[model samples]
Target: MRVIAAKEFSDRIRNRWVLAVAAVFAVFALAISYFGGAQQGAVGVQGMEVTIASLVSLVIYLIPLIALMLGFDAVVGERERGSLDLLLSMPLTRFELLLGKFLGLSAALAASTLAGFGLAGAMLVMQWPEGSLWHYAGFMLSALLMGMAFLSMAVAVSVVVADRARASGLAIALWFFFVLVYDLTLLGILVVSEGRLDLDFFPLLLLANPADVFRILNIFSLEEVKTLYGLATVIPEAYTSPWLLAGIMVLWMILPLSLAAWKFK
Candidate 1:
């Protein structure tokens, strides 16, 4: 297991794709922060906050995109290249192979996310002395878990689908549906239903969407606007507590990884 994981980890670190994706995230993070920081205002803050928020919102989509790019070929690519037969002939079991690939790919995602956002967080803190470091850290952490969930989703899809192109396409389509269309669909339902539904039902509905949960958790930092997006203007701040939000975020990470593991096995 260790040897397989090590080999997979080394392969990922040595791959050009990992470096390219990391570069893209780094450039976007720095460029947005630099331009957004120079124009600091409530408008600027909202703009800057939105810029970061946009990245968080896209975490689900982006992570799976990277994962499929990296791993849609994990088994099938090797098979097509005529390497899988040799790999299977080795002492390593299929479970070890799948797990090692998953872990190594996960590590790649984590490293890329951390490096890009870590640099961006440092730049933002330096550029704007008044900004909240804690808030930035909290959001970065939330984005990491969101990324993991998407990576797991991609892995599960890759394992289930035999054709590499189909697996990649399915992974991307799932991401698009969840990120772009899911919220719009939910809002449509809410609009048609009116305010008849209880406020408590929102959290239950939110469980269906890791992205929305992520949005609410990150946006909670904007205390000034919390009332506007709050459960209700009459409700106390405690009604939208951060710890509860974090718990929901944790569940998103665990559930997807479990499904992936089961599928792969």
Candidate 2:
């Protein structure tokens, strides 16, 4: 597993994928961090809270797509290239191979996210020279967790689907459903039901989508942001607990990859 994981990460390095992703992240994060408050008739690092508030949408939409694209072919691509059988002939269990692939891809994703956001964070520190670093750190950490959840889903898709084409399609479909459709669908249900639908279960429904969980994790933590989204009244304090939401994100990471391990055998 270590060898496979090392090889997978090495391949990402060899292909310059890590650098490319980090660059994308660094550029975007810096842009958002510096200009996040432009609409208020001013710009530049307004505060860690406002900066994180602006970047939340970017993390929710962009990271998942990148992770899915990176991992949608982990196994299928090996099979397509006629190397999967050779890999299996070696002294590795299916679970080991699946885990190695997931972990390796996960490491690459984590590194890029860290590198990108860390650069932006450092810049903010240099410019502002004050604020709780913990807030910015929390935002970066949540972004990593959310990225892993999507990457796990992509790995599962790669394992279950018959071909790379199908895997890619399914991955995109998952992204669209979770990132775009899920929240709207929930809102629609609330609208159509007109108080008939149990309002009590709404937060639980949001938990069903890792993206929403991620959004809540970042957004609700900010007093400056709470009233803007109006979710302050909606989500109970228990659900907004950072540790609980993070555990749910970890669960999101595990279940799909666990399913992939099961199916890979």
Candidate 3:
């Protein structure tokens, strides 16, 4: 597993794909961090907490898309290139291969996220100088978790599909459903029901979507952030615990990977 992971990481790094991703992240992070408050007629830094809130929206959209693109071809691409047979003939378990791919891709995602967001975060620190950074730290951690979860889903799709074309299609469709359609569909239902739907189960529905989990984890983690995001009125206080949401995010990462492992075996 270690060897496979190292090879995968080295391959991505050598291709400069990781560097390209890091650059994309860094550019977006800097743009949003510095100008996120322009709509509010403010400029520059805009407090670490406010910057985190702005970046949460950006991360939710971008990270999952990047993760899916990264892992959608992890297995299928190898098979298409006629490398899977060569890989399987070696002295390694399917679990090791699958896990190695996951870990390697996850590490790449983590490195890009940290490097990109870390640079922006440093700028925020330099600009603010007196603000606490724990909230921003939490945002970065949650972003990583969200990326891993989507990457797991993508890898699972790659393993299940017989061809790279199908895997790629499935990956993009998953992104569309989870990141775009899910919330819109839910909102549509709520609107059609005219506020008559049960409120108790709404949180459960939100928790079911990993993107929503990321949003809730960051938005509700801090009271000030919550107010800035305007989720306090809709998201009940009972569902705001950071540890609880983090656990759900973990489950999101594990369950998809477990499915991928089973299919690979």
lDDT of 2: 0.89
| Cα shift from native, residue 58, model 2 (Å) | 0.9
Q: How high a TM-score does candidate 2 get?
A: 0.96
Candidate 1 on 152-212: residue-level lDDT in tens? 6666676677777887788778777768888777677778879776655555676566666
Off by over 4 Å in 2: 129-131
Against the reference, the lDDT scores of all candidates come to: 0.66, 0.89, 0.86
Provide the lowest-lDDT 10-residue window in model 3: 124-133
What tens-digit string does per-residue lDDT give for candidate 2 at 86-201?
A: 99999999999988998999999988999988887887866554554777788889999999999999999999999999999999999999999999998899899987877898
lDDT order of candidates, best first?
Answer: 2, 3, 1
Off by over 4 Å in 3: 129-131
**Which residue pairs show collisions in model 2?**
none
Residue 40, candidate 3: Cα error in Å is: 3.8
Residue pairs with backbone atoms closer than 3 Å in model 1 (clashes):
none
Question: What lDDT is obtained when candidate 3 is compared to the true structure?
Answer: 0.86
